[model samples]
Target: MKTAGGSDAAKRRAGERAAEDVADGFVVGLGTGSTTAYAIRALGRAVDDGLEIRGVPTSFQSRQLALEVGIELTDLDAVDGLDLAIDGADQVVDDADAAAHGALIKGGGAAHAREKLVDAAADRFVVVADPSKLTTRLERSVPVAVLPDAHTVVADRIRDLGGEPTLRDAGEKDGPVVTDNGNLVLDCAFGSIDDPDELATRLSAIPGVVEHGLFVGMADATYVGTDDGVETRHY
Candidate 1:
């Protein structure tokens, strides 16, 4: 079989990891992204293969995929602690693919708030990715999740930080891009970030902000798949 390549590659790797993890059967947290879509498909396969796990999709799109794949569904408000969360990062470390000490910018699919919510509820968060998504540093690709109604104002704040902030297109040509929570995503180009933890904290303090794309101290480990093989990193 051909390995996943290009933009679709990361999802393929992430899906494999999710497949392995989901087999044990526990409450699982799903993410949104091309890489994450792979996990969704894998979850469907797992269910088809007799895996028993309930899923809390981070976005409506993910929810639909989960249902299509036959993963059991549960309401976010009804769930307590989750067994594990298999997610995908926009970037990982080139060497170790570790999520720790690495800056993560997600919510490009506008699932930031829900993703963070599920991650926080999980005892373990494992981020799956391909090597190209890995980086020496984090925050270069800061994906900011914002309320669709207050986007322009929040973007202005990003500009105040001396960076160019662009409203993230939800890969659609019609209608405002809707997040699972009905928000918009702002892809901010802040260049190299020196303090990601601080930025995550500051962004969350903003009103009308359900959540930001920063995952600090949330991920416990990461599994990075490369052309050579898979590299595991524990936080």
Candidate 2:
């Protein structure tokens, strides 16, 4: 499914702005999604202009895009540390507290597992989004990647935690949407999230869950794209 967010122009503005922070000798974590695709392209131009950098892509889609854009690819295991990670959010809660300022709901693309790993390993993780992604509170569905065999059990556990879990199906294909890691995704709805961190912890403790979409305290900043320009928010 296409990710729900702002206009394509706004997304491009935010993404390009985030790419400005990548230095000449940096190792970047390239995230998946339409917003992040702009950043990858921007970085590609920079590389064409003699900027030296390597990228660790968070998903197969991202890796393919990076290659097409002429951005050199590297595996996460080969990188000692990533200088930065440019990513997108499905929804971002604007909180006053710095700790929760950029609390995000991701995985609309069902790549949260790899995105989380690469993003968390970066020295700085920046989120790019259109204004539509910003919100007073998080009310979006949280996606959880689970082992195929444990999907039913995980759904029961998610229900015990007061969430409604639905297996994400492939829209064009006949079977369920399979992730790069060969797992099934369960999109869980829990109305408005009161404590994202607590919920994140609980989701992580689930036996079969590979990763959950609640990215609490991961983003260092967010660049929100507007019709006119981009607004940067530090978390």
Candidate 3:
């Protein structure tokens, strides 16, 4: 329930807790984000201890981290399915539908497109985050990945949908932030999201939109870390 900026300790707690679910001989989807990085490192330690598992990284960052940690890497093409996936969210809220897991706003790192594919393929998807990432309602800017040539057109369509879209710029480089798939990101702010599913559909309806940050009913559980401990919420 905490909403302030999450401390480093909290992020580590949530991440490491999620990593405990990984088992030997399982195929795991390694997610991208600072919190998920801890989970990756933990898995690396497990591998060092002789726990064998294959990882399908959701982003270049995660792929590099997985290699650095010595986790064996595999692509989605090589695996029929994943046993589990551990990811992080920019913001999370309980799903509107009671039977569904939860709604999440991701893509703060511009990797949501690939993250979605890897996550949805897993039998179980777990979200690792600090309490600060949870919210009663999702209001963060939604990231929409679009083809570079279609960015302008997508922006116009997004504006017509009553949302303000800003092309995300790279912090350490010039020009717009380019995704690993060679797409541009539009961080669209829609204020408080009343219906995430409806919005997700609208966003996906736009041509050239590769993916969006709204993750509705995708998470199976969320591990939220606090200053002193961790809490698990099941959907």
Question: What is the lDDT of every predicted structure here?
Answer: 0.73, 0.93, 0.92
C-alpha positional error of residue 215 in candidate 3 after TM-score superposition, expressed in Å: 0.5
lDDT tens digits, residues 1-235, model 3?
Answer: 3334578889889999999999989999999999999999999999999999999999999999999999999999999999999999999995445432478999999999999999999999999998778887889999999999999999999999999999999999999999999999999999988888999999999998999999998888999988899998987
Query: Could you tell me the TM-score of candidate 2?
Result: 0.97
Candidate 1 lowest-lDDT run of ten: 1-10
Alpha carbon lDDT at 49, candidate 1: 81
| Selected candidate, larger TM-score, 1 vs 2 | 2
- Judge candidate 1 at residue 58 and give its lDDT: 85
**Candidate 1 vs. true structure, TM-score:** 0.86
Q: State each candidate's clash count.
A: 2, 0, 0
> Residue 121 in candidate 1 has what lDDT?
90
Predicted structure 2: lDDT: 0.93
Q: Give all TM-scores, in the order shown.
A: 0.86, 0.97, 0.95
**lDDT rank order:** 2, 3, 1
Question: Residue by residue across 1-235, what tens digits does model 1's lDDT show?
Answer: 3444344554466568766876566898987766677877887887888888889888778888889888899977887778888787776544354434645666656677888888889888888776766667675657776777788888888777776877766455765566666677777787766667877777777766667787877777777765545677776
Q: Name the weakest run of 10 consecutive residues (lDDT summed) in model 3.
A: 94-103
**Which is the winner by TM-score between candidate 1 and candidate 3?**
3
